[model samples]
Target: MPALRIEGYVIVSADGRLADADNVMPDELKFEGDKRFFTAALDRADLIVHGRNSQEDQPNAPKRNRMILTRKVGATAPDPDNPKAILWNPSGASFEAACAEAGVRSGTVAIIGGPRVFDMFMDRYDTFWLSQAPRVHLPDGEACFPGVPARSPQEILAAHGLKPGQPQLLDPADGVSVTPWRRVA
Candidate 1:
C-alpha cells in the first residue's frame, strides 16, 4: 500500500467553540481568507473526509474526492447527489476500503470535522491546521472537541506529539490566525 498522508483543518473561536449553540456555523463566523486557505489546501489532497453533519452542512460544496463518515449501514456507495463523495459506514467498511471506493490512490487526505470526526482521527493526523478567531467569543456554543475533555486545542495537539509552527494571519482585521502543527517523528 502506498503511503497516504493525513491532515486536519478546523476553525474555532476564542472561547474554543467550533459552532453555535444550535450546532450550526454562523455566517458571521465565516472568514473569506480561511475559506481560501482551506480550498487551496484541499486542492493538494487526494481525498477529503468528514462526518455526516459536515457533509449535510455543505450542500453546495464543490465536487471533490470525499468520504462522508456515517453510521447508516449499507451506505457503501457513492452519494448519488455528489459524484465525488461517498457515504461510508466506517463500522461496516474500513477506511482503506472507503479510499479505494473513492478512487484515491496516494496523496494527502484532509480531514474536516465535527467534534466526533475530529476525535476519531486524533491519533492518525500527520499535520493539523488550527485556525482561530481570538477576539470572537461564543459563550453558548459547541466546542471544537466536544466529547473529549481537553483544556485547549494547542495543549491537545501538543500532547499528541504535534509541534506547532509559526502562525499566519488569515484575516488581520478579524483577528483570525492559522497555525500548522506537524507530528513529531
Candidate 2:
C-alpha cells in the first residue's frame, strides 16, 4: 500500500483548542518553534490536498498538482492560472482511491485542511507532519485541526510506527522551529 501523508500547520491554545472567531490562519501567532517546522513541511511536500476554504485562506498557495475535494460541481478552480487540478467529489470508497486514480500512489500527498477534510481522512494517513505551535491566542478563527481529540504528536507517531526527528530552530530572532518525522515500520 502506498503511504498517504497528512501535513498541515496549525495554531492551538496551550490546552489544544483549534480556533477562535475570525477564521484566520494562526501562522502569525505561532511560536517560533512551530512556525519553523511548518515551513519545512511545506518545502517537503510533493503534492497538496486541500478544501476550497483552505485554498482561499492561503496567501500564495502553491501551484502544484492539487486534489481538491468538493461538492460543488460548478465551482471554479481556486487558481485558474496554475496547473489544473483533479477534482474528487465526496463519495464512493475513499478520497485515497480518487488520489490513486490521479496517480498519487507514491511520493508525498499532503492533505492540507479546513477541518472536515482532515477528519474524513485521518485514519488513512500514514504520517502527519504537524507543527505544534507554542501556546498562542487567536482572537477569532477555527482550530487548525478541529474535532481531533487530544493526541500528542508523540502518541500519534507511536501508534503509526513513526518517530519524531530532531526539530530545527528556523530563526532564533523570529522564534520559529521545525520538526521532521519518518515512519519506521
Candidate 3:
C-alpha cells in the first residue's frame, strides 16, 4: 500500500470553535491570509477529504478531486452531482480504498473538516495546520476538534503527540496566526 501524507487544515476562534451554534462559519472567522494559505495547500494536494458541510468554494474546486465523508453511502460511491467527487463511508471502506476509488495513487491528502470528521483523523495526520482568529470567541459554537472548549485545541494536539511549530502571523491586522502541529516521530 502506498503511504499517504495526511494533513489537516482548520481555522478556529480563540475559544477553539470552528463554527457558530447553527454549524455556520461566521464571516469573522474568514481571513484573507488564511484563505490564501488554505487555497495554496489544497491546490497542492492530490486528494481532498472533508465532511459534507466542509467544502472549498474556490474557482478551481470543481476540478479538484475530493472524497466526501458520509454515512449515506454504503462504501465508496461516485458523486452524481460532481464527477470529481466520491461519497465515502469509512466504516465500509478504508482510507486507501477511498483514495483508489478517487483515482489517487499516492500523494498528499488534505483533510478539511467539521468536528466529527476532524476527530476521525486524530491518529492519522502528519501535520495539522491550525489557524486562530484571536479576537473572535464563540462560546456555544462547534469545536474545531472533539475535546475543544473543555480542552484547548493546543492541549488536544499535544495530547495526541503533535507538537506545535512556531506560529506564523497570517494577518497581523486581524490578529490571525497559524501553527503547524506536526506528529512527533
Candidate 4:
C-alpha cells in the first residue's frame, strides 16, 4: 500500500473549538493572518479533502483537485457540483485509490475538516497544523475532535502521537499562533 501522507489543517477558538455549537464559523474570530496561512498551505497540497459541511462553508475556494468526503454520494463518484472534485467514501475506496482516481499520483493529502473528518484521519496524519486564536473563545462552540477527552487541541494532537514544534506567530496583534505537530514514528 502506498500510504498517502495526510496532513490536517485547522484554526480553532482559544477554547479549542472549531466552530460554534450551531456549526457557525464565527466571523468575530476571523483572522487575516490565519486565512493567508491556510490558503498557502492548501495551495501546496496535491489533494484537499473537505468534509461536506466545510465544503459548503468555502464559497470562493481555490482552484485545486479535491476529494470531497460525503455520505450522500456513492462509494466513488465525481462531485456533480464541483467539476474538479471527486466524492469519495473511504470505506470502499482506499486513500491511495481515491487519489489515483482523482489523478493524484503523489503528494501531500490535506484533510480540511469538521470534527468527524478530522477524527477520521487522526491515526494517519503525517503532520497536523493547528492554529488557534487565544483572544477568541467560543463558549458554546464545536470542538476540534468531538467526543474525545476534553483536552487542549495540542494535547489531543499529542495523544494521537503527534509532537508539537515551536509555534509560529501568525499575527501578534491578534494573538494567533500555529503549531506544526509531526507524527511520531
Candidate 5:
C-alpha cells in the first residue's frame, strides 16, 4: 500500500489569513492560476475529503470518489447530482476506519477545509499547497488553517517542515499571487 498523502490548497492574505469577518473568501482569492493548480491536484487524487461547508461551497462537487466528514450526517444528504460523496461522522474509530476503507491507494488524498477538519489532520498531512496573496486586512471571518495564534507564513511553514516550492505570481497585471509548499522530510 502506498503512503496516504494529504494535500491542501487554500488562498490566504499576504499576512497569512484565510478568510474575512463574514467567513467569505475574497473574490481575488480564487484566481484562475489557483483553479488550474487545484484541478491538476484533484486529477491525481484517488479520494477527496472535505468538510460539509466545503462541499456546499464547491460549485461543481467532483464526480470522483469523495468522503465528507460531518457531525450531522443523518440530518444532511449528499448532493443528488454528485454520485461520489460518502458521508461519515467525524468521531473517533469510525472516522479512521472509514478513511482507511476509502481505498486511497496510489494517488493523492485531498483534504479541502473548514478549519476544524484541517486542524484535525494537519500533523498527518504530507503537503500543503497554500496560496499566499498580497497583504489584505480583514475585520472578521474564519481562517485558512485554525488553532495556532496568528503568525507569519514563514513561521507556520517552519513548524510543519514545509518549504515554498513554487511561487506563481499571478499576472502582474492582475495583482494576485499564489505559492505552493512541499513538506520537507
Candidate 6:
C-alpha cells in the first residue's frame, strides 16, 4: 500500500480558542480565504478524520469519505446516516484498520478537529496547517489543543517536534494568516 500522508487543519483566535464558551465556532472566526483554502485541501484528501462533533460542512460533505472518531463504537462500524462515513473507536482498532474499513487504502488523511481529536494526531501528522485570526480573542473558550490556556498552540506543536513554515496571509485585512507546521524527519 502507498504511504498515507497525514495532515491537520485548524483556525484559531488570537487567544488560541477554536470555539466560543458554548463550543460553537462563531462567525468572527470565519474568513472566506480560510474557508476556500480548507475546502480545496479537503477536496484533495482521500479520507477525512475528525471527532464526532467536528465536520467541514461543505456542499460535497455527503460525498466525501470520512471517519468519525467516537468511543461509542467497539472498533469500526459503518455510519448508518451517511454511507461514506465510518464511526471509529481508536481504543478498539488501529488507524490503518479504520482506514481500510472506510475503503481508503492510501492517499492523504485530513485531520480537521476538535481539541481532543487534534491532540490525538499531534505526533502522527506529517504537516499541520494552522490559521490564526490575530484580531479575535475568545477568552474562556475552547482551545485548539488541550495544552492551550496554559501553553500556546505553537509551543505544544513545537514540543511535538513540528516546525512552522513561513506564514501566509490568508486575509490581510482581517489579519488572518496560515502556517504549515511540518514534523522534523
TM-score of each: 0.91, 0.65, 0.98, 0.91, 0.79, 0.98
Alpha-carbon RMSD to native, per candidate: 2.1, 4.5, 0.8, 2.0, 3.3, 0.8
lDDT of 4: 0.83
For candidate 1, the per-residue lDDT at 112 reads: 89
**lDDT, candidate 6, 51-138, per-residue tens:** 9888987897887999999999899999999999999999999999999999988899999998998999999999999999999999
Error of 6 at 38 (Å): 0.4
User: What's the lDDT of the predicted structure labeled candidate 2?
Assistant: 0.57
Clashes of each: 0, 16, 0, 0, 4, 0
Candidate 5 wrongly placed segments (more than 4 Å): 56-60, 73-81, 94-96
Query: Which is the winner by lDDT between candidate 1 and candidate 6?
Result: 6
* Model 5 lDDT per residue over 1-185, tens place: 65677787676766556666666677756667666667777767778887766742444445577887766655334545466776667653354556565654556778777677766666666777766566455536566665433766556655777777767776465556666667777
TM-score leaderboard ranking: 6, 3, 4, 1, 5, 2
> Distance from true position, residue 4, model 4, in Å?
3.1
Off by over 4 Å in 4: 1-3, 56-62
> Quick one: RMSD of model 5?
3.3
Q: Which sections of candidate 1 miss by over 4 Å?
A: 55-60, 147-150
* 63: Cα error in model 4, Å: 1.3
Scored by lDDT, model 6 comes in at: 0.94
